[model samples]
Target: METSTASPPANGRVHHPGLRTLVQTTRFHAEHRPDTAAVICEGRTLTYDALHRGSNRVAHALRAAGLGEGDRVAYLGKESEHYYEILFGCAKSGTVLVPVNWRLTAPEVSHILQDSGTRLLFLEDEFTQVVEGMPTAPPETVVRLSAFGTWRAEHADSEAEFEATSDTPVAQLYTSGTTGLPKGVVLAHRSFFAIRDALASEGLDWIDWRAGDIALIGIPGFHVGGLWWATQNFNAGTTVVAMRAFAARRAVDLIRDLGITTACVVPAMLRMMLTEPGVSAEDFTTLRKTVYGGSPIAEALLEESLAVLECEFAQIYGLTETGNTAVCLPPAAHVPGGPLMQAAGHPYPGVRSKVIDEQGRELPPGAVGEVCLHTPARMVEYWGLPDKTAETLVDGWIHTGDAGYVDEDGYVFIRDRIKDAVLVAGENVYPAEIENVLEAHPGVAEAVVVGAPDERWGEYVHAFVVPVSGHEPSPRDLHTFLVPRLAAFKLPARYEFIDRVPRNPSGKILRRELRDRFWNDSARKVN
Candidate 1:
């Protein structure tokens, strides 16, 4: 609701410190933009001063409840101002903010809370029943965020007396279990600052950060975009407009009404926005940058987005383990050329990226191999899993497990994921979970889930099942069985009754073979 024309320094460089350690922009804005809108959601706005004070109050309340440094506090709720407030409050207290995906089933939710040993849980009105039902959830405490409650009026104007520093763990984001079970990725405050600096070094002009800029964040807050984008915006003293979830209509409405300058969306979300009913080009005028990632955006959809949004389109690629973005495809590179569409651009400053062979040897340009990244922005390790941590982080590099290549121009191009993880609508769905559910059905003997290209979701979940002796279930039957067990997004879009899933000598499902049928030589497969 407020506007400022001052741009960041023009040297394509941004000085970033730890989330809590960085006080320049934060303190400056707390004083200057106290009355300006900071976070806007569903017709509700919280100004800079209010957000800062609310965060301080939340921090105080957390500490009073015995939450402290290195402690994991589960944020189980929808996307709203409460999400950011709780997360930032955790940062202030040096506590680890574990944002639970609200879509998870009760059992799945229990697994996360138990696995992470979450000491406290902050719930929304919708999830109160779920938390109440789980008796064995960490045993610390649970608090609800709502207007009417026994919760005191704890909106403190003074900063909470909490230790917040660079080495503090700010987030413990769980990887969407698309390969095996989900693992908690531990990210430190240093990693956040490192990424901001890395992006600035990779040709991201700091001047782009205008204090008046409103970032339209439609992505779910549980993911990296929600965490990192908010950090970046807060560090630059920019305003953030939080949409609870991605609805194409709602996003377009906000873009037009709020004069949103930038938005971070996946390919599927972009497709929906471009094709939204009654959406006009004028609706996206204030929009300046459209950052697309999570999954590769096809050339066709990219061009369509360019035409419709009429803004600078940039591409970024990274995983949760790498603090979200390691490589970037700048707006200039997103031209009508063939190479630009496929290239995810250069690695960020202070980050080293390369294509590596199975032997860990670096591959040459144009040679497709596993993409490897080394950056200070990378996570410290997987929480409570030392062996797995070692396997992922070796020699200073975090194995991305994604297949890609580097062009002569130093741009990176993603080909496919080497990990047996299925990306359904940008959400990582592990085949093991889906297969486990399928095997639970009396009619299913063996099952495998794999990623198949889709025009709509970038990739769709596909299940290959082997029916048990004297029993067989149709696709509808499987759907019915899974409806109550899994989230709607994780449900397989297509089910194929197969004789036996392709496997090697070790009996590991040859996901490549299953995926090849759809993604072979195709940018995307709709079905």
Candidate 2:
């Protein structure tokens, strides 16, 4: 059951406990289940007692390196069981944990390191070459944690010295820019725990896997899904099964062979798993629940998954600033014709969501507007971008910039991005609506819409499309498919064939880059 010592205050503001606040709970599970396995990595395992002691040692080592409250340390590596030990250790030591993106190049990584003013970086040997070349890399400290023994030997019992208070920032997730350069979003300790409590309040109990239950993590640990899985599984005393990288075949084999009871995946990953060779409905019997998000799952895919996996699926939605998830669509909501899949679900227990216009005026149900979220889980602010922060966050509501509509039942239906709206012949057209129409074409595999410069019109709608394998549809055929369905001005003025559209890990199209090529050399950038 959801438990909180304090209640929500007035005007949707509520004070909650901190992230390091759960250390005692960790300690409790450790003492009671000392020898029980806590983590499973490459070929080694660590028990709850071992993880507790190992992290305590990490705290001591970090302190010896001059790390303490208010200092930020970044980690650039793949997801492993040891990652959490380092994260929890930072949580205990009152230091902020900054997880860097491993997919990025050295220069990309350098930008974050320099921006965060990261005092120390803990990286695996795989990234040694990348780190050695970065001139902007911090001189604070560099440590290599290879094996559990190395950490255990240098460890000191300093758990007491490491305590994170409610207001202390726990971690920082650098935003994935759909606009400009990424900004670091700092989350507080209280913010983390409160959201966890909110998840529980909705009868969404943490998976009750015992110490022997293998919890497979396929996504990069730097992402929220991977991080949440590690901590929550440890919090529930489950054994963590780590994957350095994701391979669909390997992920399926692990679940079938290792008895993995819990897992998390994004919509794209789920789609890949369903298409993997030799994959069968029986192969997923060991998976008790699968948590998916990052983008909406199509009804067709959801149905196929329900039939094949035969397990509970939870669709959660939230940003880095909202502490992973402020809303979740539970398994029961997955039934056919149910309202859940059509929405992002209601706000998490302590979270309040509303649809509003640019002026912050609340819109009535069924009206499309920006999705605004107000929660204690909001980050302190965008790191070093006070002006941008003020523009995005107003009156405590983080303007999602996502155009969505809420039904009378409080269900949210995301439409598209406000910035993605294209202007053609003095009319505004949402690319998502156009893409949706295009995706419905049987011969269309993928489609992305962007505004291109036009002499007559300020901007014209252009579509970059991918045709289905073994099927060829001419431009005239494709245009015919849309002409009958959409307004003339909203139709694509031009179309180009492509193998695929460029997208971020979250599956959001990089429209700006698509438009950059032509606009860069144009006399009038907007023409």
Candidate 3:
């Protein structure tokens, strides 16, 4: 219950050093920098004072709606100031905020809503039809984004008395269903602040935040990267600019116009922005750093990004379960042709990493195996999946399903995936998820999906199919059928009609064999 007064830190930083929970951060900033902008989205600005009071009102509304501690309140929409308000409100009221990826299909969306056992849903005005058309029923209380202002205004803006610790769960983000159904990764308040506190103690500027820093949330809030990055800036009491949805051209304009000093983006987003018409280094004059990750970046793309951005570049690598990034390739190691450029980088302060074999024994340096990370920022657990929670997380370590090795110098090099998940433009698209829908088509007797290298997207989903005797379906026919069932990113970019799919003696489909065909010419197995 310790709090700082309205006086700013002597170092010129605006954040409260004593703030531990998300609610504390909002309250601290509201007291010190009440008039400063906490979040700016699509020309709307929410000041720190307004955000704190607004979230207080939201917390009252949630309590009045009968939601209690640990209850899930789902937000189905794009990134906005309202989203952050609800996020902090949930933190204050002890409710967990579940942000759904707006791009997902109705069925995919339905699964998350049902799986999380959400009690209330905040739907965007545009997605009302999507929710209404859903095969499954939505929550009992559904509030549209258009009516949120009025609804929230009905409640008092006074702060609520709720006891929350650093370990209190604040957000539950769903994974990409690597095993066929997305699991909610429950993250607590510490997930956003633990690593920041660790690095601050070490005097490391690896991914430093400044007083006037204006960070652009390039990634969607539904993703760990976006949510983590935004909160990181907020913890520092800096200005945050979020996009409704990532558009390359619009991002460029925001950086130039808003004087965005730093941004968190994926490699594909960098590629698109660099290739955007009329974009130049001049447009990025105010941008001091660009933190890119979520997918592997080709050497060629990294080289171009460095030359064009003309700013510090840091690469991050981790998972939703690891609370975003446990490893970081700091700006200092970003040499034009350095060997470390190929590495996934070293673990951040207070983070431990190792490569482990299939039997769970730690592997030696230079040996390829599943990468494991232990960090204070790790997620609490997978909501409602005890077996999965035990399997992936053991003894406070996350067994990342990525095949990689740690070198003698401690740099991590990721070579391939231990899991059969594909990274499409920073989105995790599991082959099984796509194969399930593809096989449902009468034209496809059997189907196997894999990731294929692409110059544009880091990797594109490719499917190999065994067509039914007389009902051979063209790629177009299957694409049309799958469009309404899956997210656009999960759809196969290319399809191969074959007599049969390769399999082993145990009848397991040789997914790697089919995937190897696409990456054989490349040096790395993964794109």
Candidate 4:
């Protein structure tokens, strides 16, 4: 009957990455904590044993569909247990999982499918028409996840006989850039939990993943912060309750209904929840810890949230390329109106971070420069981009595009971003990508995009356009044109008709000249 599960690979090709794959963790929890809940959403709960069996079926079914080791499979959906099942399934069978941003336009989704050469795509049935409308051909095998139960039933619920180790490439999360193309950050399973596993081995329970802890995931599935934080609990056999989409009321309701003990959100998300009509301080009583990150937090927002939530509030700073949180501002250091709260906390265990000058020389403490990190959590490479991999992962240090400084106490303070990335409500919106879309219009001669300060959303995408001699483009006109090409968050909120965009001798748009006006009075250059 072949009921026995496949054993860990003996190839020695994996070369002892010093970490366990998701497959090993799932099986271990299923055997040791069979009845513990791993995930909960939309009135359904998947216990450890159930998650293992479901993922096993998915792995076997995918392999039967002609997908082999190292093949690429993609998922496009909102948050759900089904997503995790497919993710762990891919992990079990040595297939790479690419989760596309569901909010992306058809053209955006098409670009990923074509770029990755994906063979299989699993998605919600309602989005079938989206795949049909792709600018390029969709994957060869498309499975409607609405029929997942039947599809899984047709395959065996046992581990696929395969050779996969912790070092095997597992996920490819796309991060867009100034080059106007998304770069896939290929990560291994070992890097996924490198920091957490290190902390656990050292017997430190900072975030404290207890057996009965209910972790809340309110972020979108496409972003690493959303999936990465939630799965940390799942890997520890703790219960995780997640939302299909993040909304102010939904996050508040989940806390009330689930007695959620832990959660992570961006600053804007916290503001939205605080301003929600029915929300009261009592609503957040169950939250033992709330982690916020993505963009730097404003002081007033920090104070207000700490006062309202009445829970331990911590700040995490990291990038999709660094796996996750490399620096954390612990609860104790979140003192309002104090010097400690202003700086991002020290690096995580086994993580070394420093700021460097433009010449790549390490800067002394309290110097504003680019932030660089040395951590096991660094991505293996940018998928299929050798030059970028070399440029970024130099000397075992990943160069973060953020301009920041570490204080005498080792607290990192972000001053500005070296990358042309505008963060709108925690979503990374590359300026060049938006500028390209703007310049595509017949009425626009040239365009530049820059971050504008905002009370909410941290920053908004503001575009300055030099109209073509004969044609004039209004804010409404430009907004309407861009709505079809870019995500709503990435679209310019305000448009300024300009004579010409400032440029240097080399013809590079001077984004700093445009950005400086908005942040004139602020000490921090970033919004």
Quote the positional error of residue 499 for candidate 1 in Å. 24
Model 1 Cα shift for residue 53 (angstroms): 1.1
**lDDT tens string, model 2, 402-479?**
888888877777777777777787777778778767876878767788888787888898989888778968888889
The list of candidate 2 runs beyond 4 A from truth reads 1-22, 147-152, 202-214, 336-340, 455-458, 476-490, 505-508, 521-527
Error of 1 at 436 (Å): 30
List, residue by residue over 1-527, the lDDT tens digit for candidate 1. 12223325553223433233432334456776688877888888888787777677777777778877889999888778777767767777778888888876676678788888898888788987676676565446877777512442554546766655666678998887644567999988776677665554554652245546789876677888667777777776678888777788989998998899988887667766876779889999999888777765546567768988999887778888888888888787777755576677788777788899889899999887788888778888899999999998998899988877888877887766656666777676656556656776878767777878777887788888888657889999999999998999889999998887664221124576777777667754333
| Tens digit per residue, CA lDDT, model 3, 197-285 | 77676767778787888999988888889999999988888999999998999999999999999999987688679878899999999
Please give, for residues 1-527, the per-residue lDDT of candidate 4 as tens digits: 11222213441111112226776767777876789888888889999899889999999998888888878999988778999899889988789999987766788889888888899999887677788888888888988888888988898887667656667888888874324678888888877678776655554445556546788986666777876886677666678887887788988999988899889887668867987887999998899889888765556567879999999887888887888778888787888778877677788778899889889999999877789988888888988889989998898898988877899988888755666678788876767567756866878766778888788999998899888778997888888898888888989888888897664221235577888889899988676
Error of 2 at 513 (Å): 2.6
Quote the lDDT for 335 in model 4. 83
Lowest summed lDDT window (length 10), candidate 2: 10-19
How good is model 1 by TM-score?
0.77
Q: How accurate locally is residue 331 in candidate 3, as Cα lDDT from 0 to 100?
A: 95
Off by over 4 Å in 4: 1-19, 176-179, 420-527
Model 2, position 407, has a per-residue lDDT of 83
Give the TM-score of each candidate: 0.77, 0.88, 0.80, 0.78
Candidate 2 Cα RMSD (Å): 4.9
Model 3 poorest ten-residue lDDT run: 5-14
| Candidate 3: residue 47 lDDT (0-100) | 94
